[model samples]
Target: MLVLGIESSCDETGIALYCTRRGLLAHALHTQMAMHAEYGGVVPELASRDHIRRLVPLTQSCLKDAGADFADIDAVAYTQGPGLGGALLAGASYANALAFALDKPVLPLHHLEGHLLSPLLTDEGVDFPFVALLVSGGHTQFMAVHGVGDYVLLGETVDDAAGEAFDKTAKLLGLPYPGGAKLSELAELGTPDAYRFPRPMLHSGDLNMSFSGLKTAVLTAVEKARAEHGGSLPESVRNDICRAFQDAVADVLAAKAAAALRQTGLRTLVVAGGVGANRQLRQRLCALTIGKEAVQTFFPPPALCTDNGAMMAFAGAMRLRHGVQAAAPAGAFTVRPRWPLAQLSP
Candidate 1:
């Protein structure tokens, strides 16, 4: 089956084509990071407008790269919810209209489910019945995956997600917008012991975690450093803070992932979402083990870690392959900007 996927959940507009027999044919993406950076963060109105501008060209580009045409697409799949209402609508309306035009069925996929299932796109070894650690800018949670469309929430953040904390902390240290990745880059140059930050909910005896407290701790440390440096933080000191902050987040995630594995007796861990691309987090997860058995960890390629059309396309194809019913094309449709992953039915 040939499935075309559209992703406009947030600041990125992604489009792709996937074939059940041939895997991912091609994908195209346009990120609004540069534009949003000027505003210190994503402005939803701008993001929605950009999606409208990019979707058609990107879809054409993807089709050209795949050597396919609109008539060849067997189904249309798109992110339906759990994102900016406008952004989701941009993709959803396009997908539904396209599907209606082609007389193809539409598969409205859950955004987080795309992230959770992304690893399967490349890793042939990862099977069903695994634990998933979804750490992204908007969310951080652990889920027990039994199969496609079968997910159980294991635990999640009580407050800010790990990636949000990273960005917020980076901003505190005078980094630019979209500061998470930059903070990580500077962390590589940091001294490990130069600073220490609290690891919130590390031993709360449950899978739930928290990072808001950690962000506050970083703020406190930054204030102290600025005071000592005569109201200016030294570059070296900033790097040190970055390292400590990254280390703390990595530790918390690694520990909770291990705990989830222990609780579920599932040794396979699939890490997805943007923060899953963190080199430090990857290193820790790669080396993680529970008791005597080493855990097998899987990550989507770095490019796929963020919101993208490839994951959405791949996810939609998987659903059709697995027997999930696709909605017939219709004139009217609605989007759920706050849909919960747990509410998805098999």
Candidate 2:
């Protein structure tokens, strides 16, 4: 089947074409990071407008690169929610409209399901019945994957997600907007033991996690540093703080992931979403040894780790193959602004 995927969940507009028989045919994306950076964060109005401007062109580019035309598409898949209402509407409306025009079915996919299933896009030999660690800007959770559309929530954050903590703490340190990646980069230059941060919920005896307290701890440390340094934090000190924070987050995630694997008796761990691209987190997961056995870990390509159309396309294809019916018609469709992954089933 040929599926055209559209993703406009937030600051990025992503479009792609996926062929069930040939894998991902082509994809295109336009990130609003630079624009949102000027405002210190994403302005939803601007994001929605940009999605409107970029979607058509990006879809056209994707189709051109795929060497295909609208006539060849069998379905239009799009993110339906758990994201900005306006951004979700842009993609949802476009997908429904396009599907209606093509006289094809529309597949409304859960955003987190896209991230959870992204690892399967690669030939990583990842099978069903694996544990998934979905760490992203808006979500942080562990899920037991039995198969397509069959996901059991293992645990999740009680407050801020790991990525949210990263961005919030980065801003507290005076970093620019879209600070997660920058914070990770700065962490590379930090001394390993220059600072220490608490690992929240490390021993909470559950798969559930928490990062709010960690962010508070970072804020406290920042205040102390500023007070001691005459209101100016040294670059080295800031980098060290970033490192410590990253280390603590990575440790918690790694520990929880291992616990989830043990709980499910699933040796394979599939890590997906934006924060899965973290080098430290990747290293930690790869090195995770649960007792005498080593765990297998999988991750999408770094470029695919963020919100993108390819994962959506691939996920839609899987759903279709698993007998999930698409939306009956494009008219009178609505997007879910807060859908949960566990609510999905084949």
Candidate 3:
């Protein structure tokens, strides 16, 4: 089966083609980071408009790269929700319209599910019945994955996702928009233990976590540093703070991942979402061990770490391969901007 996947959940427009027999054929993406950076964050209206502009050209590019035509598509899969409503609508409407033109079935996929299943796109042999740590800009949660479409909520953030905290903390430290990645880059130059930050909910005796308190702790430290430096934070001090903040997040996530593995008696840990690309977090997760058994961690390729069409395509193919029903037709469709991963039916 040939499936075309469209992803416009937020600031990126991604399009791809996947074949059950050939794996991912080709994928194209256009990120609005540079545009959104000028505004300090994404403007939903702009994001939606960009998606509308990029979808057709990107799809054509993907098809050209794949050496396929639109007529070859057997099914169309697209992110249905859990994102900016306008952004989701842009992709959904385009996908439905295209599928209707081609007379192909449509698959309304969950955005988080696309991320959760992305590791399978690689050749590393990630299997089912594993614990998934889905950490991204919008969400941070642990899930118990029994199989495709069978996911159980393990734990999640009570407030402020890890990536959100990273960006917010970076902004507090005078970094630019989309500060999470920049903060991580600076962390590499920082001194360990120079300015330790709090690890919120590290020992709450449950899987649920919190990062809002950690962000406040960083704010407090930043204020103190600025006050001591005559209202200006030194570059070295900023890097040290970044290191401490990254370390704190890495430590807490590592500990919780281990606990989840132990609780479920699962050794495979699949890390997904943008934060899965973090150097410190990857190091911590790679070295994770529960009791005497070492945990096996899987991550999508760096390019696939962020939102993209390939994950959606691959996920849709997997569902179809497993006999999940596709939408009857693309006559009338709607987007769900706030759909939960747990709401998916097995």
lDDT tens digits, residue span 126-227, model 2: 988899999999999999999988889999999998899999999999999889999999999999978899999999999999999988888898999999
All candidates: TM-score: 0.99, 0.98, 0.99
For candidate 1, which ten residues in a row score worst on lDDT?
323-332
Candidate 1 local distance difference test against the native: 0.93
Taking the tens digit of each residue's C-alpha lDDT, what string does model 3 give over 1-346? 8999999999999999999888899999999999999999999999999999999999999999999999999999999988999999999999999988898989989999999999999854888889999999999999999988999999999999999999999999989999999999999999999987888889989999999988888899999999998999999999999999999999999999998999999999999999999988999999998888988999999899999999999989989888765556887888898888988856
- Candidate 3 residue pairs in backbone clash: none
Which segments of candidate 2 are over 4 A away from where they belong? none
Order the candidate numbers by lDDT, best to worst.
Answer: 1, 3, 2
Q: Please, what are the lDDT tens digits per residue for candidate 1 over residues 54-131? A: 999999999999999999999898999899999999999999988888888898889999999999999899998999
Model 2 Cα shift for residue 147 (angstroms): 0.3
Model 1, runs deviating above 4 Å: none
Candidate 1, residue 24: the lDDT equals: 94
Clash totals in order: 0, 0, 0
